[model samples]
Target: MTDRPERDALRPRLSGGLTVEVIETSALGDRSYVASDGEVAVVVDPQRDIDRVLAAAGRLGGRIGLVLETHVHNDYVSGGLELSRLTGADYGVSAKDDPPFPHRALDDGDIIDVSPRLRIRAVATPGHTFHHLSYVLEGSEGPVGVFTGGSLLYGTTGRTDLLGEHHSEELARHQHTSVRKLGDLLPDGAHIWPTHGFGSFCSASPAEGDASTIGEQKSANPAFTLAEHEFVEQTLAGLDAYPAYYAHMGVRNIAGPEPLDLRAPTHADPEELRRRLDGGEWVVDLRSRKAFVKSHLAGTVSLGLDGPMVTWLGWMIDWGAPLTLLGETADEVAEAQRELARIGIDRLAAAATGTPDELAADRAQLTSIPVATFTDLAAAFDSGGSGGGGGSATDGELPAPDVVLDVRTRSEFGDSHVRSAVHVPLYEVTQRAGEVPHGTVWVHCGSGYRAAAAASLLARAGRDVVLIDDSFDNAAEAGVPLES
Candidate 1:
C-alpha cells in the first residue's frame, strides 16, 4: 500500500474552476490533477513511479476516468497501460495511424470529460511525432490550459526529425497546422504544460521559466511566430542524433512493457565475469566518475549505478555486448541490475567482487594500459596529435600506438578526440572491428568502461590492444589532447 499525500499537498489550487496539482513522480515523468465539479483528473504521462499516480487518484476521491499522452515518449518507459490497470481510466492518444495502446484513438476535434472537474479537448500537433496530440483543458472560466506535450514550448517547438518512418514533410505539415490551430483556438490565458522540461533532449529550448500563458507562447514560440516552411526547416537543423535506445522504446511502448520488479539486483563473480567477457560481454562500472577514477576494475566503464543507469548505458554502451557489473559494493550491484532491468538490458552475467580480486583471480585476462590524465588527452588533441588510443611517447617514453579507436557516442566523440583516430562507436565496434586494421590499438572513453571493453574484445580477437586508466579529470590534467 502506498501512502497518499494530502490532497492539498499535490498543489495549491489555481484561480480558475479547475484546481491544478503537479506530482513530481519520477526523473522522467509526472502526474497532474484538476479537481472541480465533476471530480476529474487528467494524467499527462507517467514513468516507473506508479504509486504516486495511484495516490493522486486516491486524493481526488473519485474515479480517474481519463489519460492524455502528448506524444510517444522515449526518455523514460511509459506506464500508460499500468496506470489504466490500476485505475479504470480510458486512455486517449493522438496517434491515429499507430494506435498501439488499447485505449480509444483521438484526433483533431475529439473532446472528453476526463473527470467531473476536468475536460480535455484534443488538438493535433505532429512535429514531435507524426500522430502527436496536445490537450486543451477546459474549466468553469473557459479553456483553462494546454498540455503541449512536445509540440509547442514557451519559446520553441518539438523536433521533427525523431520518427524516421514518418516523413518529415507530413510531420512538418501537421505541426504547422497544429501551431496555427492552437494559436487560433486557445485563449491567451490557457495554461501551457509541457512534458519534457529541463534535462530532456526532446525539445530544442531549455525548460527554464515559469509556466507561460497562450498569449506568451504565441508571441514567443519560434514555430508559432514563423511561416510554415521556415519553421519546419529551422526545427530540423538543431536536432542532435537521437539516442540508439529510442528505437527500442518505440516498440516497447506500442506492445506494452513487460512488468518490472525492482527488488532483485544482478551481480557476478570473477569467473562468471570472465566467461561473459569471453562471450563478448561489456563490463560496466556503476560508480560515479569520481569513485571510478579512484580505482575500478581495469576494463570497466563508469556509468553511475543509479536511476536511468540502464537507459543511459544502453544509449551509450554497445547493447549487443552482454554486461558484467563492477559496482562500488554489494548494494550498488543490485541497484545496477534493477535499473538496467527497467529498460530490459538484463544481460548481467555476474557481479564483480572488486577490481583487485578479479584481476588477481584472472591474471591472464588482466591487461593494463598506462592511464592518461584529462590534461594529457586535451593537450594532445589540441596539438594536432593523437589523444587516448595511446599517443606516441614524445621523450624517452614508449610511443603511443598508430591508431586510436574511440567507441563513444558521436556527441561524446565530437566533444573532444585524439588526432587521426577512427571513430567506431562502441555499439558498432564489434561488427566494424574487421575494418579497424590490426595494430597496437589503444582505447579510451569518458571513463575507462567502454575503452576497456573494446580493448578486451580486440585482444581476444588476437589483436594487440591497450587502454587508458585515468578518469575524465586526470586525463585532462595530464594534458591528454582533446579534438573539439
Candidate 2:
C-alpha cells in the first residue's frame, strides 16, 4: 500500500484561502493535489489510486465537490472517474478529448468558484496534448498557482512526441506560445504545480529542480526563453520514445478507466507457477539482475524492482495478459504490485517469493545467462570472436549467433553507440525480437537497467544471451567504435 499521509501532515498552506496538500507518486514522480477552502475541495489530476485522494478530502472537513483533470493523462490511469462516482462530485475534464462519461466539459477561460474561499480559471495550454488546460487558482492576492498537467512543467514543458511524430512539431510550437501566454497572463508570484516531473518520461528534459514558481520558471525554463521556432525544434530534438503503453492511456481516460484495486495478489505454489510459465504467461521475475542471472526459472522474464519499473512494465508487457511474479522478498513483491496498480495493471494472477531451489519443488534445473563488462565485450568484438551463444534448452530447443543489440533509444544510438549494433530500443524488444536474429543476443543500454530487462526477455524466449552490465561511457573508454 502507498503510504497514505494525513492531509494535515502535508501542511496545506498557500497564499490563497486554499489549503493544499500534494499526494506524490514516487514511482513516476507525479503529484495529485487537493485544494480546498474549508467548505469544499477539488482534486486535480489524481492517479488511479483514489484512496489517497478520498482521505485528503475527508481531512479537509469538506465534501469533494469537484474532481478536475487538466488533460487526458498519458503516463498512468487517472482516478477522476472513480473519484467522481464515489464522491458524487461533478467530473470536469477538457471537452476536446470527448470523454464518454458524464462530465462538465471544461474550456479555456472558464472560472470555477468552488466556494467563497476557492476559485479557479481554466487556461487552454495546448502543447503537451492538443486539449490540455492549466488551472489558475485565484486568491484574494491574485493568482496563487496553476495545476499544469503536462503543459508548463518546472524547467521545461511536457514532451510533445508521445502522441506521434506527425503532430510533434505542431504541438511543440503551441507549447512555446502556451508558455508565453502563461507568462503574460499570470502574476510573477504564481506558484507552479505541475503533475509530471522528477524523471518522468513525460518531461522534455530534466526539471533542474522540483521547486515551482512562475518567476523561477520564466527565468530558467527553455520554453520561456527560446523563440517559438527554436523552442519547437529543441523540444522535438530532445524527446526520446516514451512507454508504448502511453498510447493507450489517453483513450482509456476518455472512455473512463476502471478504478484501482489494491488488494494483495494470490500466492501461487511452484507447480502452479510452472504451469503458468509453460502456458507462456508473462511470468516476471522481479529479482535483481545479479540474482536473476545467477539462477532463474527457465521461461520467466526478469525485470528488477528498480529504476522506472512502472514504465517498463507498461511498455514491455502485453496488455490484459495473464501476469505472475516471483520476487526476492515479500516486500519487493508488494512494491512491484503497487507500481503495477498505478498503470491499471492489477490483474496479477498470482505472485510468490523464493529462490530457484525453493521455487523448484520438481528439482527442475535452473538456467543462467552470462554477464559481460563493456571492456571485455569490446576486445572480443574487435578480435572477431563475438560473444557466446548456444545454451542448453530448458523448455524448448532453438539455435541462436552472437548478435549485439543496442537497447538505447534511436536518438541516443544516433549520438553515439557501438558500430554494427542493431538498435531495437528496450521498449520495442519484446514485440520486435524476430528482427534480432537467431543468436546469442548481447544487450546493452545507456546504463545496464534496460539491458537487464532485455537480456531476461531474450532468455525467456529461449535465446542464448549475455548482459552488457556496465555504463555506456565504458564502451567509448574501451575503444568501441564511435558513431555520430
Candidate 3:
C-alpha cells in the first residue's frame, strides 16, 4: 500500500490514547512509528535518520525513552543503536540475534511500561525471521495496536526467502502459524501497524490496503481464509526477488550499524572525474532516465535519482570501491545521498553537479543513446536479426549487437518476454556483461528506468548499447514474438 501523508505528518492514525506519529521514509516507502503517552516515547523500526524520530516525539510532548526493533531487518539499516546512544534509551532487539551492541535482548511476553497507563508487551511472532517479535501497545482498557514489523502484515506476512532459499518452504509454513497466533492473541478491535507494507520488499504477499484491524484481518487475511497449505503455496508463489543489498543487512545490523553522517559531497572538477573513471572507479549519474538516455557523460553509469536509486546503488556498486555522484544540482545529489544513508551507504568519494557542455567539452566524450520501441527491434529480429553493435542495424551509424539484453528481473522475464530476449538482470549486468558476444546490445526493463542504467553500464564496458525506452505492456500489441 502506498501512503500519501502530508509533507511532515504521519498517516492513518491508530485508534487509541497513545499519540502514534508515523515517520514514513517515502524514498524507500517504509514506515517507522513514534508512539508516546504524554511522558515516554517508544520508537519502532527507525531508519538511519534519527533526528526526525526525535523531532516527532518532541512534538508530542515526550522524550524518547525506548528504541525497539521487531527483528534483524533485511531491507535497510536500523538506527536503534545510534538513536539509543544519543538518547540513552533502552534499545530492544530480538533476543535470538544476540546483537553486539548494548541493548535489552527483548523476549516474547516481556512487557515494557511506557507510562502509568500505557505498556508495550512483546509477542513472539517468528515468521519474518526466526526470532521476530511483535509488540502490542496496551492501554488501560486493553490492546490498542500491534506493531507487526514484518511478521504479520495487513494482508500477508514477510518473505521467508531472506533466510536462505533452502529454508523458504519451512519458514513459509512457520509464518502461517505465527500470523494466526497474532490474530488469536490480539483483540479483534486492536489496530494493525506494519512496518513493511508500503514499498519495502519484505512482504510475502502484496499489502492490500493502507491499514487494517486485527478483526478485519482475521476475517479477510489469508491466514484466516485460506487453508494453511494453500496459504503457504500462494505465499511461496507470490514472493519476488528482493534487492541484492538485502543479503548484507542482517550481518551488518548484528555487527552494529554506524549513525548516519551526511559526509559533505565536495565539488570535483572534470579532470578529477576523468582520473577516477580511468582508474576504474564509478561515476553514478543521478538524472531522469530520459535525460540520461538523451545525454550523459562518457564512462558514467545511470541509476536515476527518482526511482529505487539506493537499492540499485547498493546492489550494483562494490562497497569498498570509491564512488562519485553526478547530478544537475546540489539538492539532487543530496536527495540521492539521503536515500543511500538509509541503507548505511554513508560515504561517497565525491559528488559533482555538471552540465552537458562540461561533459562534452571534448566532442568524442559527449554521450547519448537512443530508446527503442519493442516493435522496431521485433521486426528487425523477425527478419533474422540479432543485435549488431547494441544499437539498431536499422540506424546506419553503429554496429549491430549480437544479444537483445532485457534488463528486467528474472521474475518479470519469467512471466512474459520476447522470445529472442536474453535475461541479465540490471544489478548483475556488470559481472555478466563480458559473456555477451561483441555486438550492439539492446537493454530494457518493464519501464525504461533501468534500461538507461543497463545501457550505460554496457557502454562504459565499451559495448555498443541501445536503451529500449518503451513500456513492456506494448510488447504483444507491437507484434513481438513472446515466450513465457
Each candidate structure's count of clashing pairs: 46, 3, 18
Task: Give the local distance difference test score of model 3.
Answer: 0.81
Off by more than 4 A, model 2: 1-12, 37-39, 58-63, 329-331, 378-402, 437-439, 478-481
On TM-score, the leading prediction is: 3
Model 3 lDDT, residue 321, Cα = 78
Clashes of 2: 3
1 against 2, candidate with superior lDDT: 2
- Compared with the true structure, all predictions reach lDDT values of 0.62, 0.81, 0.81
Cα lDDT tens digits for candidate 3, 1-484: 1223534334444445677888877657578998887788899999887877888888878889889999989889888899999999999988888976799988889999878767999988887788989999987777888899988787777888899888888888888898888888988888888898776778776688876889999878887788889988988888878887887788889899987888668778877887787787899989888888777778888888777778787888887678888988888888788788788777788888867567544656678886778777776675566643333465554335467888887778999987767888988889999887766777778888888888898989998787888899998898877889
What is the C-alpha local distance difference test score of candidate 2? 0.81
TM values, all candidates: 0.74, 0.88, 0.91
In candidate 2, list every pair of residues with a backbone clash. Answer: 400-439, 401-439, 401-440
